[model samples]
Structures are given as structure tokens and as C-alpha cells.
Target chain A: DTAVSQTPKYLVTQMGNDKSIKCEQNLGHDTMYWYKQDSKKFLKIMFSYNNKELIINETVPNRFSPKSPDKAHLNLHINSLELGDSAVYFCASSQDRGRMKQYFGPGTRLTVT
Target chain B: AQTVTQSQPEMSVQEAETVTLSCTYDTSENNYYLFWYKQPPSRQMILVIRQEAYKQQNATENRFSVNFQKAAKSFSLKISDSQLGDTAMYFCAFMKREQGAQKLVFGQGTRLTINP
Candidate 1:
């Protein structure tokens, strides 16, 4: 069984469109995170949630928002997506808040045209 | 702020040979954790190994081992008996022991190719 899973492995959308990427973890982890891997393959954290509460918010634009309905699900919503938003989005989860090992899901490739 | 650096952008090794991927980090806090992650063409990030700062002994996982130098602030990954399956983009990461919230800082990454 997949510990962490993301829907729509590949997403292709036009600029100014709104899109949502869903992530779910079966590991019963309390912490979940969203990371963006740009064209240069530099992975950066965009947001993090702990037990359905927002914990960490990077310097991401206001157009992007993350919602966690429960400890097992974290979803990312991007509004008015721009060309620069084209990149791979990764979802990860860990058991604790400290520096613990994380389990990542198969990334979602989002191409904004 | 913590930073992880993988000096080698790319590396290649013949099958059955051993290869080492170097990684160095900078941090003010004395307590933290280090990790080595591998991402193949499938773009799935997999944890190769992890090392805790308080532990003096190095960490080893099967064919993978890490040389953790706390004073030098270096953590390098060594792969023995390299196989083609080992070819992937290796990332070195750091995690601070912060309360409530914790995040990983990843290096630029090193692409290792294992040729048979």
C-alpha cells in the first residue's frame, strides 16, 4: 500500500486558471507538507500543516493556499496560476514535529501554460 | 538559517565499484538531524539514510553508509558495490530540532550515474 499518494500525477492548465492538487497519507502522520520543485530541480517548502492546523508558511504568494481537512489529508489550491507556477509539487508527511524522517508521495507535475 | 550543499553536481561510477557523494552543511544550532534522499527518473523521493547529531557513531544502511563529521559540519554518503539501480539524483538534507514545526532544507542535489 502507498503510504502517501497525490492525485493527478500530471496536470496541464492555462494561465490564470484555478487548480487543486490533493494529497493523502495513510501513515497516520500528524504533520504534512507541500514542496515545490522548480525547473532547476530546487525543492522548496511552500507550506506545512500539523493536525489540520497551519504551522509553516513560506514566502509563497497569496494565490496559493493549503487546506488540511484532517491529519491524513492536505490539499493545495492555486488561483490565477502563473507561468512561474509550472513545476513539480511534492507532498510529504512525518510522524512528529521534530527533525524526523519524512515519507514523500509521487510528485504531481504541474505545467502552467 | 541552515544550508546543505552537495558540491558535486554530477558523478559516475562503474557497476560493482564504490562511490562517495559529498555533502556539507552549515548551522548555528548544535542539535539537529541529517538525511540523504534519492530521486530517480520516476521523481519519487526516497530516504536513503539518516543521522542524528548527538550520535557519534556513523549511520549505515545495507550498501549505504554516512560519514558524519560534526566539527567539520560535513555528512557524506558512501555507496558500496554500486548497481545501476543506484543511479539517481541524490539530495542531502538538514532538519532543525525546532518545536511545534520542523522543515527540511535540501541541497541542490548530485546526479549519480552507475554504468554497468
Candidate 2:
């Protein structure tokens, strides 16, 4: 079983369109995160949720939003996608007090045309 | 804001040889966590190793090990007897020891290739 899994591993959409990526973790983790990896392979944290509460929201654009229906699931919705948004999006999770390990999913490769 | 830096953009090692990937980070928090993640061609982020700031003893897992210099703010990964399976993109990540969710600050990553 996959510890963390994301749907739509590779997504392609036109610019200005809306898309969403869903994530789930079977590791009984309470904290989940969304990260973006740019073309240069630079990874940056976009959002973090702990037990369905928003914890960390970096200086990301307003078009990006994260929803956590429960502690086990976190979904990302993007509005008015742009070419600059084309990158690999990753979902990660860790236990409530897990300070050393964060399990990650096979990232979603989003393409904005 | 804490930042992780992986100076080596790429590295290559022959099979059964050894390779070292360097990483450095800057953070204001005294107690934190450092990690090495491996991303293979399948594009999955796999935890290779982890080190806590409070622990002076280095962490080792089979063929993977880490040299954590807390005072120097440097954490490097050493792979002994590198195998073809070890070829992947290695990332250095840092997370604060806060009470809630941990936001991982990741480095640019180092691409490692193991030759046969």
C-alpha cells in the first residue's frame, strides 16, 4: 500500500482553466503539506494543514487553495491557472509529533498550456 | 526563513564505489530536523535518512549514512558501495520543531548517477 498517494499523476490543462489535485495518506498522519517543484527543480512549500486546520501558508498566489476534508486527505484547487504554474506538485504527510520523517507521494506533474 | 542548500548539482559514482552529497542549511531555530530524500526516475519522494539536531550521534541506515555537523550547519549524506538503484535526485530538507505541522524547506537537489 502507498503511504501517500496523489491522483492525476500528470495533468494537462489550458491556461486560465481550473484544476485540482487530491491527496491521501494511509499512514495515520495528522499533518499534510503541499509543495511545488519548479522547472529548475527548486522545491518550495506552498501550504500545510494540521488536523484540518491551516497552519502554514507561504507567500503563494491566491489562485492556490488547500482543503482538508479530514486529517487523512488534503486536496489542492487552483483557479485561473497560468503557465508559470506548470510544475510538479507534491503531497506529504507526517505524524502529529513526527519531527524527523515526512512521507511523500509521487508528485503530480501539472502542465499549463 | 530557514533555507537548505545543496551545493553539488550532480554527482556520479561507479557501482560498488562510494559517493558523498553535501548540504548546508541556515536556520534561526536551534532545535530542528534535517533529512535526505531520494527521488528516483519514478518521481517518488523516498526518505533516505534523517537526523535530529539534539542528537549528536550520527544516523546510519544500512548503506546510507549522514554526517551532521550541527555547529557548522552542515548535513551531508554518504552512500557506501553505491548501487545503480541509488541513482536519483537527492534533496536536503529542514523542518522546524514547532508544535504543529512542519513546513519542509528543501534544497535545489543533487542528481546522482551510479555507473556500472
Candidate 3:
């Protein structure tokens, strides 16, 4: 069984279009995170949710919003996507808040044209 | 802010050989954790090993082991009897043991190619 999973492994959208990526974790972890890997392969944390509550919000644009319906699911919605949004999005989950190892899902490759 | 650096961007070694990937970080906090993650062509992040700052002994997982030097703020990963399946982009990461939502600070990454 896959501990972490993301839908639409590959997404190709046009500029100014809105898109949403869904992530679900079956590990029963309390914390979930969204990370963006740019073309240079630089990974940065965008948002984090612990027990369905927002815990960390990085210096991301307002166009991006993360919603957690429950402890097992965290979804990312991008509004008015731009060319710069082209990158790989990874969903991760951990058992606790700190010092715990994070399990990552197969990343979703997003390409905005 | 904590930063992790992997100076060697890429490395190659023949099968049955051994290789070491170096990583260093800068942080004021004494309590923290370090990790090594591997991403192959499939683009799946897989945890290779982990080390705790409080633990003096290095961490080992089968063929993968970490040499953790807290004093120098360095953590290096060594792969023994390297195999082609081990070829991947290896990343060194850090996490502080604090009271908030701890996030991982990853290094630039090292692409290791295990030749047959």
C-alpha cells in the first residue's frame, strides 16, 4: 500500500488557468506538507498542516492556497497559474510535528504554458 | 535560518565500489536532526538514513550509513558495495528540534551514478 499518494501525476495547463492538486496520506500522520521543486531542483516548503490546522505558511504568493479537509488529506489550489509555476509538487506526511521523518509521495509534475 | 550544502553536484562510481557524498550545514541550534533522501528517475523521494544530533554514534541502514559530525556541522553519506539501483539524486536535509512546525531544509543535492 502506498503511504502517500497524489492525483494527476502530470498536469499541463495554460497560463491564467486555475488548477488543483490533491494529496492523501494513509499513514495516519498528524502533519502534512507541500513542497515545490523548481527547474533547478531546489525544494522549498510552501505550507504545512497539523491535524487539519494551518501551522506553517511560507513566503508564497497569494495565488496559491492549501486546504486540509482532514488529517489525512491536504490539497493545493493554484489560481491564475503562471509560467513560473512550472515545477514538481510533492506531498509529504509525518507522524508528529518535529524531528520525525517525513514520507513523500510520487511528485506531480506541473507545467504551465 | 539553517542551510544545507552538498558541494559535489555529481559523482560516478563503478559497481561493487564505495562512494561518499559530503554535506554540511550552518545552524545555531544544538538540537536537530539530519537525513538523506534519494530520488531516482522515477522522481520518488525515498529516505535513505537519519541521524540525531544528540546521538554520538553514526546511523547505518544496511549498505547506507551516515557519518554525523555535530561539532563540524557535517553529515556525509557513504554507500558500500554500490549498485546500479543506487543511482539517484541524493539530498541532505536538516530539521531543528523545536516547539513549532519543523520543516526540512534540504541541500542542493548530489547526483550519484553507479556504473555497471
Candidate 4:
């Protein structure tokens, strides 16, 4: 069983379009995070949710928003997608905030044309 | 803002040989955690090893080990008898001990290629 799972491992869309990535964790973790890895392979944290509450918000654009329906799921919605937004997005979860190890999901390769 | 730095962009080693990946971090927080993560071609991040700042003893897991120099703030991963499966992008991360908001600050990552 996958501890953390993300849908649509690959996504291709035109610029200015909107898209969303869904993530779920079966490990019963209280903290979940979203990270973006660019073409250069630079992985950076974009957002984090703890117990269904938004906690860490990196210097990402306002067009990107993270919604947590419950503690087990966190979804990312990107509006007005840009060419620069084409990158691999990864979803991760940790048992408790910061002190515990994080489990990551297979990344979603998003391509914006 | 804490930062992790992996100076080597890429590294290579022959199978059954040994290789060391260097990492350094900058953080004012005295209490923190360091980690080494491996990302294979599948793009799945795997935890290779972890070290706590408070513990002076190095952490070792089978073929994987770490050299943690707290005074120098340098944490490096040493892979003995590297295997082809060890070939991947390795990242060093730092986590603060604070509760409720622990985010990992990652390095640029080192691409390790093991030649069989």
C-alpha cells in the first residue's frame, strides 16, 4: 500500500489554463506538504498543512493555493498556469510537525505549453 | 532562514567502490535535524539516513553512513561498496526542532552515478 499517493503522474496543459493536483496519505500523518521541482531539479517547498490548517506558506505566487479537506488529504490548485510553472510537483507527509520523518509520493510531472 | 548546500552538482563511482557526498547547512538554531534523501529515476524521494544534532554518534544504516561534524555544521553521507541501485539524486535537508511547523530546507542535490 502506498503511504502517500498523488493522482495524474503526468499532466500537460496550455498556458493560462487551470489545473489541480490531488494528494492523499494513508499513514495518518498530521502534516502534509507540497513541493515544486524545476527543470534544473531544484526542489523547494511551496505550502504545508497541519491538522487541516495552513501552516507553512513559502514565497510562492498567489496563483497557487492549497486546500485540505481533512488531515489525510491536501490538494494544490494552480490558476493561470504559466510556462515557468511546468515542473515536477511532489506531495509529502510527516507524522508530526517538523520532528518526524517525511514520506513522499511519486511526483506529478506538469507540463505547461 | 536556514539553508542547505550540496557543493557537488554531480558525482560518479564504480560499483563496489566507495563514494562520499558532501553537505553543509547554515542555521542559527542549535537544535535541529539533518537528513539524506535519495531520488531515483522514478522521482520518488526515499529517506537514506538521518542524524540528530544533539547526538554526537554518527548514524549508520547497512551500507549507508553519515559523518556529522556538529561544530563545523557539516553533514556528509558516505556510501561504502556503492551499488548501481545507489545511483540517484541525493539531497541534504535541515529541519528545525520547533513544533507545529517543521519544514525541511533542502540542498540543490547531488546526482550520483554508479558505474557497473
lDDT of 2 by residue, A1-113 (tens): 98999998999999999999999999999899999999998889899998899988889999999999999999999999999999999999988663557888999999999
**Taking the tens digit of each residue's C-alpha lDDT, what string does model 3 give over A6-98?**
998999999999999999999889889999999988888899998899888889999999999999999999999999999999999887744
Q: Which residue pairs collide, candidate 4?
A: none
Put down candidate 1 lDDT per residue, B83-107, tens digits, no spaces. 9999999999998744455689999
Model 2 residue A77 CA deviation (Å) reads: 0.4
Point out the higher-scoring one by DockQ: 2 or 3. Answer: 2
Can you list the residue pairs that collide in candidate 2? none
TM-score of each: 0.97, 0.96, 0.97, 0.97
Error of 1 at B61 (Å): 0.5
Once model 4 is optimally superposed onto the true structure by TM-score, how far is the C-alpha of residue B95 displaced, in angstroms? 1.0
lDDT of 4 by residue, A1-107 (tens): 99999998999999999999999999888889999999989999998998999888888999999999999999999999999999999999987744469899999
**Poorly placed runs, candidate 1 (over 4 Å):** A97-99
Interface root mean square deviation of every model, in Å?
1.2, 1.2, 1.5, 1.3
Worst 10 residues of 4 chain B by lDDT: B95-104
Q: What lDDT score is found at residue A35 in candidate 4? A: 94
The alpha-carbon root-mean-square deviation between model 3 and the true structure, to one decimal in Å, is 1.3
Candidate 2, residues B1-116, lDDT tens digits: the string is 89889999999889999899999999888878899999898988888998889999999999999999998999999999999999999999998845587778899999999999
Candidate 4's DockQ is 0.71
> Which scores higher on lDDT, 1 or 3?
1
